[model samples]
Target: MKAMTYERFGNADVLELKEVPDAHPGSDSVLVQVKAASINPVDYKVRQGHLKGLIDTVFPVIPAWDVSGVVVKPGLDTPEFEVGDEILAYARKDFISNGTLAELVEVPVRTAVHKPKELSFEEAAALPLTGLTALQTVRRAGVSAGQRVLIHAAAGGVGSFATQLAVLAGARVVGTASERNHEYLRSLGAEPVTYGDDLVESARALAPEGFDVILDFAGHSAMQTVPDLLRDGGIVASITDHRARDVYGGQYVWVRPDRANLAELAGLAARGSLKIEIAEVFDLAEAAEAYRKLETGHVRGKIVVRV
Candidate 1:
């Protein structure tokens, strides 16, 4: 099987397309024939060794976690899935190797869920990590009907999902983005505010009383505005910054794989209540290029790599 492998932490230049051993299912895991995989900020971050202290790296590492593919075989203990089942997963393991960027990947049943027929493989591939991150943050902040919510980076991959989910919960959403993405944020049901020195003023202009919940998907000191933007008793959640909890008495979210949450997201996509936008699609051999585009940090939605 051909995969994008990197021997050591570095830039996208380290990624190489080469033939590697084929993957097989292990107990409680499934071997998926990859149809598509999506690129996340973490993919590039991991490639650059940003997560070295947290996750041990093995040589010749395959560098993606999100996958949508067909199951070619299931492990003996995996009664919930079978051969020929189409599924998607955030296939992160305790260690870094055997990822989904390859033609074949071993996905644990704990993280895999059935892909809805309504989603194309590309769309399904785009949902897992970002979708789950958005869902977890929103739930942590207790976003609900009639509440005022603020989302940082509202036009990026995870922020896009968070914006839509908060809106569906009936919250009035104010999202931060550049002027170019303002219209795009509006389409996702958020009142768009431009990010800059005047961000707090702009957000205050939209919601004079302060927001009931603030979700930060952007890490560049996004939590600095929490004191000014959140209501006295409101909650905050940040995926990028620990200050949301350590300093602000809010939650710092690390997205985990939940089969039920993935299923709910899939159902929402299938019902047309949630939208998955594909900013660009690249072939497997061009995955390094895909990472470069994602690192640009201006993509409106998800970048996918088709196998």
Candidate 2:
């Protein structure tokens, strides 16, 4: 199998597209014929060696989290999937050693879910990590109907999903993005707010009392605007700040994969209650370029790589 891999963490420049041996599944894992995969900010961060501590993977790593593929083989006791089943998954962090960047990937059954019939493999590939992150954050914040929710980086991967999910939950959604993405955000059921100086004021003008729940995906240092935009009793969750225990007295979200939750998200997509936006698509050969775009953090939605 051909795979894109990094012998050592440095930058996208260090990634190489080359032939690699196929991966075999463990007792409770499934071997998937990867049809599509998506690039996340974490992919680039790991490429650049920024997340070595968090990911804790060795060198020569296949870097990808979101995968949509068909099961070619199932290991012993893996009852959730069978050969020939179409599925989507957010591969676990500890297993980054062999990822969906390859023509095939083998993962534990716990992370896999049936793909939404309404979504193509490419679109389904784009949802897992980002979708799961948004779902977990909203659930952690106790987002409910009639409350106002604010999502930072609303035009990006997780933000796009978060906005839609919050709205579906009946929250008045407000999202921050550049001027160009205002309409797109609004289409997702969010009142668009721009980021920059007085960003808090922009959100405040929309909801004078502040948002009842704030989910930030704009990175740790960029989440400084969250506190002011949140209602005093509101909950705040940031993919940027996982250790926000002291920073936000409410809840802090640490995204984890849950097969049941992934299934629910798939159900939402199947029913048209959730939307998966693909801002860009790249071939497996263009994995480097995909990672580059994710690092820029300007993509309107997710960037997928077709295997």
Candidate 3:
């Protein structure tokens, strides 16, 4: 099978298109003939060796974790899916080896879920990682109805999903984005604030007393203000910095794959409650170019790669 592979840790320059051995499913997994895959920040970070100390990696690694495809074969021990089943998965493992940017991928049955019939393969591929990240982060922050919620990087992949889910949960959402995306955020039922000098003040102006919840998807110093932005007993969650625990008594969230959550999201998408925005699409052979675009760090939603 052909895939985007890297010989060693580096930038997008290390990735190349190459034909490799076919990926076979493990006893509890399923072999998916990938129709589409999605790129996430973690893909590039792994390529750059930023996660070297964390997840184990094998040489000539395939890069990506989100995939939507049809099952060509189900593992001997996996009865959840059979041949011809269309599915989607956040195909992450304890170690980084096989990945989703390929013609075929082996996904653990535990994390693979039935694809939402209402979604195209690209749309199905786009949902798993970012949607789960946003959903779990919001849940960790314990967002609820009538609360004031603030989301950083509100127009980016995870942020967009977070904003919508928060609104659906009945929270008054305040999202940070450039002025160009303010209207974009508003359409998602969020009040937008520009990200800059007076971000905290701007956020304060909206909720004078303090926000009930703060979720920061944008790393860097944007979270430095969370300690001051929240109302008493309010919670904070950060996907970028675990140090949020020390600074604001908040949770630092890392999204994990869960079939139940994915299926629930599939239901939401099917019902028109969850919207996925595809910023761009690339062919599987163009994985390197896709990584270049992702590294720019400004995609409004998800980027998909058709296989």
Candidate 4:
């Protein structure tokens, strides 16, 4: 199998395409022949060793978590999948060694889900991580029908999904992005507000009484904006801020793989209730360029690598 790997933590420049040996799976896993895989900001962050203390790493690491592919081999006890089954997963592991940025990846059954029939391989590959983050984050913030929710970075990967899911849940959604993405957010049913100098006031202008819940997928900017945006007793959840919990008495989220949740997201995508935007698609060997583009933080949607 050919895959991209890095012998040490650095940047996209350190990654190289190499012919690696095939991977075998444990009894609870499935061996997937990769069709498409998507890159997240974490992919580049992990490549640069940002999460070094939290996640153990090995040399020659293949870095990625999102995968959309066909199951070529199911491990002995993995009845959830079989040969020829199309699958997708957030495919993260307890430790870093093998990943989905390759021609073949071993996915644990717990992280795998059937792909949405309506989505192409690239679109299916885009959902697992970003979609799950948005779903879990909004839920943590107690988003529900009739509630006014504020989402930071609403046009980016996680925020885009958050906006749609919040709207699907019947929440009045307001998302923050650049002016360029305002129309895009409106199409997704969110009231788009631009980010910058007066974000707090801009958000307040949209919801005078304050938002019922706020989901921060951007950064600590939420920490500064939450006081003005969230109503008293309103909840908050953040994937990017560790300081959010202490300041807002809210949840600091780290997304975990849940098969049921993945299935639900897939169903939503299939039903046209959720939309995935593929900002760019690169061939597998162009993974280094993919990671670099993802690191730019300006990508409007998911970046995919077709294997």
lDDT of each: 0.94, 0.85, 0.92, 0.91
Please tell me which model should have the higher TM-score, number 2 or number 4: 4
Rank list by lDDT: 1, 3, 4, 2
RMSD of each: 0.8, 1.5, 0.9, 0.9
Model 4, position 24: C-alpha lDDT score: 78
Write one digit per residue (lDDT tens) for candidate 1, span 1-307: 9999999889999999999999999999999999999989998898898988988888889988999999999998999998999999999899998899999999999999999999999999999999999999999989999999999999999999999999999999999999999888889999999989999999999999999999999999788888899989989999999989998889999899999999999999999999999999999999999998999999999999999
TM-score of 2: 0.96
Write model 2 residue lDDT over 1-307, tens digit each, in one string: 9999989878788889989889988998999999999988877776777775665777678889789999999999898888999999988756457878999999788899988778899988988999999999888888999999888888898899999989989999988899999999888888998888878777889999988888888865456766677777777888777544466776666679899999999989888888889988999999998888777768889899999
Per-residue lDDT of candidate 3, residues 32-149 (tens digit)? 9999999999888888888888889998799899999999989999889989999999999889988998999999998899987889999999999999999999888889999999
TM-score each candidate. Answer: 0.99, 0.96, 0.98, 0.98
Local lDDT at 190 for model 2: 89
- Backbone Cα, N, C clashes tallied per candidate: 0, 0, 0, 0
Those runs of model 4 whose alpha carbons end farther than 4 Å from true positions after fitting are none
Which candidate's lDDT is highest? 1
